[model samples]
Target: MDIDFLKSQLEDHDQSQLLWYWESLDKDSQEKLYNELKHLEFSNINGYFKQAMEDLKHASDKIDNLLQPLPTEVCGSVTGSSPEELKEYNRIGLEEVGNNRVAVLLLAGGQGTRLGVPYPKGMYNVGLPSKKTLYQLQAERLLKLERLAKQQTGKHCTIPWYIMTSEHTKQATDDYFKQHNYFGLEKENIILFEQGLLPCIGFDGKIILANKDKVALAPDGNGGLYRALRKWNILEDMEKRGVTNIHVYCVDNILVKMADPVFIGFCRTKKAECGAKAVEKTVPTEAVGVVCKVEGHYQVVEYSEITVETAELRRDNGQLTFNAGNICNHYFTLDFLKHVSQVEQENQLKHHVAKKKIPFVGDDQQIVKPTEPNGIKMEKFVFDVFHFAKNFAVWEVLREDEFAPLKNADTAAKDTPTTCREALLSLHHRYMLDAGSKFIHSDGSSLSDIPCAKKAKESGDCQKSENDDQFNKCEVSPLVSYAGEGLEDLLSGKKLVPPVQIVMGPSDITPSIIQNVTANGTTN
Candidate 1:
């Protein structure tokens, strides 16, 4: 190690304390610590810390009346579009896919700590019949979508997958995909890349050391995506691959539509350089960020940023003025990415500070976990770049069909494994019904499915009696129906019952086998 250079860098940043124990540590520890310090890139930590500390005091924006609903021309929805419009959009989107001009980007840097797991969140299995991990399900959906596009355009194409990982998930995620043979996807089409990481610091604007040998770090949120992409030449790679439009989404959304044709089609139709997939908020205070114009620029404003009265503000149609709930699903044209990457400092995405109990070297000269927040982690949300879009748009999608996020374990009240599974099963049930399929009991009596559970609850009858009927939750394979399409021939006018797994063979949809579904949601 260059002792003089290391000492100079540390002294310059007021982080020489990292080397305070250097004289006492063995040569091996010295080498480890030196190497860690050598690789750090937080030269602007002081400036960022200063700004974030001020934000914590009061980062108020005066936009009470300036907020406007997403303009009509820039907004489209599955609920609002007519069948003809949807068909046309689907056709246009598939053409882009079949031409290999579309790519899917996944933001999957976070771990599954909230979900009670040590692995990456994408590796989670959400208790479906196939027991598929989030990654596998997304891979299969892409595979199915490619085939669908081919069927529509008569051109076979491979959809490139760009997964953004972090220090915590990079190696494990790479290994998991390799072990699973890329979940029936071509290895060449799947690209896993690491995002940037920022040094975690304390309230006093000093770097925190995880151990005697290392500086503590955290993934630089999803917004670090832009800088990482530029650093790794992801933009150049996308250009070479002829990927004109990119669909980016979070990994935890189990119901995410990978390389969604309709969304891409809608954005393309509107000539949108950057776009987002929004869901109408269920209620005024639903804890979702609203996608609306702030000072004439597109951005997602958090619910807490506005007053309760402003949140409850309604439009002429009685819908909340800020009803476009941000689901972190977005579309970016290649040109948009290029410009955003090369934009001036005033247009760049800014990092937000979050208080966390970061484990660090403590009083006894050992790494310790604090019971309360003791440090800050700087992060940049991917949507923070929306303000840079020259022509932005928002596509509203059905929350139940497109936004089943898996944030926690089954123990959490919402966004749990159980809730995700039920949401999927319920959506598949609706798909079956739309395909002219029916569910019946063993004796031909009509059966109630998970979707009916909500109706039953509204009618005060969700709880089962000693003799009430059990649910026949069915799982629809994505390879069979990417969005409930192409299923009429196999499932139309069919009487299905009990637990069924509707999957497709190499050529066509196979006959589903029936099994008894118990009250505990297991199949017998």
Candidate 2:
């Protein structure tokens, strides 16, 4: 932390960037750094460096210890509530929008190399017509949710969007949002924090120093959310901001409900420290973690751990013993977070090991080669905190509209751009049908007597002659539907029909150009 000592260390690594960082520090920040170094003054510089390394290793190790399998299930049995018993939940969920609160925490630190893009995953445009990048779409969701919360609660329930970035993504992520004016979000409310990194290890688990002064480190994985929250002092910040709960989800999920109020209200009503939104497994083979009581506590068991017995567990009525699945969408209470942070015995969270390819510089520091899965990187799962909770709950939701993970390149089987596009299109498809739009038949024949199509049905009224084979069989879905629609289609719909370009909230869909759409078409 000492300026001179830091300079010497930077020189040892021959990393010019650290010098730039030091020079960029303001007076107050520099003074704070000097104070932090005061305790090290008695030790030799090398000893001080070694001590720092030890502290980091200890913290990382503690996290690793907490991940060990639990001895008992802390979560109670899943409620098999009948429709009548679930009335209150349905009522509260539908009755008010703003009455419940919402917050968005995006884990978006990695690049889009898997997706074959040059930018961050958030910056990758999913081939939509509006050309909205992942970040833009997500930011828009946050803005709309903020408005809905305000309208429903009659109070300004600010939707503070927290983005956790890594060394690889912080600058690019910030610059993209900055160029777009944070997409109309209040700049102060959009918090960005850097995730902690663990030193990269070789195949033997020995730390690989990037240079004489620093060890190469990688983002501790998504499970590192808690530590990132702690290092950034986010819990205190949330409490100070009067944010009672936080809805945490990842950035790659295009269909995630940003800070969904229903989930928040449910957690609040149940007095639960954690709330997880889940989807029933389509089948036993589906690749999703199951939310179930482990030993005796509520936890998400990885699909890999589910043996035939566990996966086949069923009650007398033939219902799945573990029906709820972990979608990674969660809600957590602020008070619980404080308690966990304060309790040292409960402080260490267990870590999951993930193997990844890491880049390493050679002895000359000239040529760098990316290594193969050399070793496992330790990280704590956010759900591992479930054990610390006194109460827990899971809310079931539709998977098609809520879960789609983008983790591969265009070449990968499931995560390709084709699949992402289809997923978005599928959401749009459902939204349109719900809006009373029918799909065009292959025969170009009408499935229903839609007013717009009816008016254009006359012979030669549109393009092809009515008598022509193409004319009688051609059918097309409505142009304007939902978020990921092509802008060209929306424009065409507007010019040819009444209203197009529908925008959607968490629970409802309306025309993006609402006033115009309503004026031209009949409003119920």
| Deviation from native of the Cα of residue 87 in model 2, angstroms | 8.6
Per-residue lDDT over 321-428 for candidate 2, one digit per residue giving the tens place of the 0 to 100 score: 666778778888777766665536234665555555655545554435565665445555667777676687777776676777788987678866656655665565
- In candidate 1, stretches whose alpha carbon ends up further than 4 angstroms from where it belongs are 59-62, 343-347, 448-472, 505-524
Candidate number of the best TM-score: 1
Residue 422, candidate 2: how far off, in angstroms?
Answer: 1.6
| TM-scores of the models, in the order given | 0.94, 0.69
Please list the Cα RMSD from the true structure of every candidate, rounded to 1 decimal place.
2.6, 9.8
Q: Which stretches of candidate 2 lie over 4 Å from their true place?
A: 1-101, 210-214, 316-319, 343-347, 361-372, 439-500, 503-524
Model 1 lDDT at residue 250: 97
What is the Cα-based lDDT of residue 152 in candidate 2? 47
> What lDDT score is found at residue 253 in candidate 1?
93
TM-score of 2: 0.69
Local distance difference test, candidate 1: 0.84
Model 1: residue 290 alpha-carbon error in angstroms: 0.6
